[model samples]
Target: MSELPAGLHDDQTNSEPIVTAHSFLVQQADLEREAAEVLPGKFDECTYDKGYIRQPLYACLTCTHPPSNYQRTKPDASAETAPAGMCYSCSIECHTGHEVIELFAKREFQCDCGTARLLPAGEGSCCELKSTRKMLAKFANTKNSYNHNFWGFYCRCDTFYNPDDEAVMIQCFICNDWYHDRCIGKAPDEGDYEDYICRECVAKHDVLRCIDTTLVFRGVVADGVDRQVEVVDAEENKAENTEERPSKKAKTSACRLLPDTVSQPMDLFMVDGWKNDICTCTGCIKKIETQKLEFLLDSDEIVEPEMDDTRGESLYESAMKKLQGMDRTRAVDAASAYHAMSIKLKEYLRPFASAGKVVTQQDISKFFDEQKQQTH
Candidate 1:
């Protein structure tokens, strides 16, 4: 028979499939044997400790070894102690195993080596020996400043340099230069009295006191810019008055004069003859007529007649009828009232274009055609 591959016999070389099956069975057996050696003892008697048992498995999970003695001596005194359930052997990994047992007994059952343990719910535990060593090494390697006074009170000075209760320091108003409070005859109590008044008050005293008059309708000069009020020269005042007097005369003549169509006898008498004649132009006449119409429209008497019989008619209807029969002056007044009403109605209709009511060119042409036909 032909020799099979290395480590195989001719009978075993039936096929590659047969060889693989045998190898898998051998692997399964080896795994089962290794598992039996590492797993916990099934029987109660087999589980008993060879040495003294400090903690139950469940409780041991929650209990950590005490922190190293060195961490206990920290200034803050808030060091975290070694937690429980961490295996000492896993933590130290010493080759001799002697150091492992010694640390295990010293740290109690809390060390990682002595027993298998479960982590308790919400409890963080660690091996004492390794954790303590880490803590000690951390403390040894760290450098702390000796110059600081960690408990000192905070200072309000700009430099923030802590000073004793009576130490004199210069107080500044605007510039950075300091004056010793005692030397300047100023008290520390004065500077400490307010938070923001020092530099501001000295620079702009007037602004500090100037009361806002928008709400009260009365203002007070608490603080304003420092300014000198110069005395007025009598000669200069007289010259200013002379210049202002002529402008006043010119303004009165231009703004106060009324056209003859609207002016009363008193107004006519008040204006110069030349102005009265010049005011009779067509433009002046139209302005006068328009004002007269506006006056009638605004007058309650025109709308609310004294007679009860005419009061029931609409103002526009009654005014139109009045215009048809009135003299030139009253006709102008009534027509002006109608014109004003039309203008107002046009303004009211203008916004309707924005609300999908725009009048197109065709609509305008149609409206004008209808009006022309009605006139005929």
Candidate 2:
């Protein structure tokens, strides 16, 4: 077996040992008996078993130990003197160190074998020790209560008022913090207390408060207003940074064919393959590419022709040729042909007006009257 350190000993032999292993066994048995006496059934015989002695010592001494290491030393005693009693466990000199002694004194308890134990117990152990323990327990309970009562370490006045009885807690949508209605300066006893007020409400309040100079001096709206203003300023700055100039292609593509003269203007004109052409705009481009594929998947069906300018033009041209070949009253035939042409022109211009073309009603009426006079 390894030899014990100089000051430490494991010796089992002694003619008359000042302190023996069995002494601690006896002391522990006595302590258990005392404890059982105070509170019946509180401690049993097995409580003083070897397992109990081996546990870490929680109590400290109130005085210093002697040099001999067998007993506690008096305050005025020198290192040459032997100690009165020794701690069975730690094997250190019996005088409780500063920390251990202080804990026992403050707690109003004494270690089983120490000079410090001589100090008179304050208010007695039953009152002082038990009260101290109760106070510590209450403090721990208060800390736990504070934790459970306040959510996210924040509580509104209303929430703190009836913390134990609140059925449903309201949480802010933004910031996700909880508050009582009364905390925000609102009456808690009012109807419909179930409503939740969030950071958004504060933000809106600040915005309104900022715009009103009266509320600005109160400082209540400053934080909220500043946040909202910062957001608006940031958005504006981003929009300015991302501003883009129109491309040359877009400007050139906007040009269109215009009328050469009012008399022979092309009222109805169509691009030959406009439906097949690909659109260039971002929104239209996607559909443009897939249009042909979509058309093929759903075969096109021919529908009956409606009376339109294109149909009117073909009918009027044939009628004019037949009118010019007629031999009886050529004047009347010319007059009738002119009237038919006027009606055809009106039909063509009507479609343009309906389509949002820039043609005035006055212009259409004037043109029709001129054509009628020419036929007469």
Candidate 3:
């Protein structure tokens, strides 16, 4: 302390040491400035929209038995995927134990693996021959277009037609079936077309003769305005029956369920406890599920791929290049600072990776700016 050591020269005139403890502070500041310049949000970026997704074709995945009389049970509350799109036969055989999802007749997809006919012949064969009706077959074969006519246009003339058919067919709201204009005694454009019924159902149900008619619905979710059930209590029914017999000439509209929506012969029968509730029929319920899937697909909610390491000049590379002209120790210090900054950028981007969001170069630049602000 009294005298300087051999290699050290004490100069009262210049007191500052050659290498100070905070000497690298200037290098670190330069690094942050350069980082701001080099790595502005530099990651790959993409945005997703639902309009690009495709609607799938018709399909079923269920047991194939004859009389196909049974319907699938309601979906389980805990299950993520709702079981829809099964045939009456499939509901009884393969899916009896599991909660059954409602099924709709799809326009494009064929029967899934669960169909009896699709199963191995020895293990599970179709108990009854599948329907060979030309219209039904045509509808099942539809591979594209998801319009209302996806089920194929069947005319009472025993012929299947398309939208391009020369003869315009009118759809009977009663049966939700199409009939050739000529078959229903209608001209191509001329007939009181407001309301119509297929000749078959009209005759079978004696629709015109009955003053009061009731539609017994099954598998219908009573959600929208079109699907609410009109409940007539026993007392109300008796009171209404005794009150009035309307004039014979007055037209009595037939009572229909879920008008303007898909209806099937199966809907004619009612299931206990389903009255005044939503229609949970396979077809209707599947439609609901399909719409939801379509929305999710459209939203582009999936995670994106990770950013490549070799992408344009990385922050580390830039730092190395900037520090090359400096002293070895200073270069090493700058590189360490750059490494710390890179680690921070990675940490910030980690959450995006988990969320399936794309991290781009622009994101990196923003991180640098934030780091620069915090350091200052």
Candidate 1 residue lDDT tens string, 214-315: 111111112332122212233343333343222211222233333223111100000111111223334434444553322211221211102234333445
For each candidate, C-alpha RMSD in Å?
A: 49.4, 53.5, 25.0
Give the Å error, residue 250, model 2. 26
lDDT of 2: 0.31
Candidate 2: clashing pairs of residues: 62-116, 64-95, 65-73, 65-95, 71-83, 71-84, 71-85
lDDT of 3 by residue, 103-196 (tens): 2222223333223223312233222223322222233222222222322225654543444777666555334456665454412223211334
The alpha-carbon deviation from the true structure for residue 245 of candidate 3, after best TM-score superposition, in angstroms, is 11
What TM-score would every model get versus the actual structure?
A: 0.14, 0.14, 0.22
Q: In terms of lDDT, which candidate is stronger, 2 or 3?
A: 3
Predicted structure with the largest TM-score when compared to the true one: 3
What's model 3's lDDT at 298?
24
Better of 1 and 2 by lDDT: 2
Query: Mind sharing the TM-score for model 2?
Result: 0.14
Clashes of each: 14, 7, 35
| Alpha-carbon shift of residue 264 in model 3 (angstroms) | 25
Candidate 2 regions with alpha-carbon error over 4 angstroms: 1-152, 156-168, 187-195, 199-201, 204-376
Worst lDDT run of 10 residues, candidate 2, spans 101-110
Candidate 3: regions farther than 4 A off: 1-113, 117-153, 187-194, 208-376
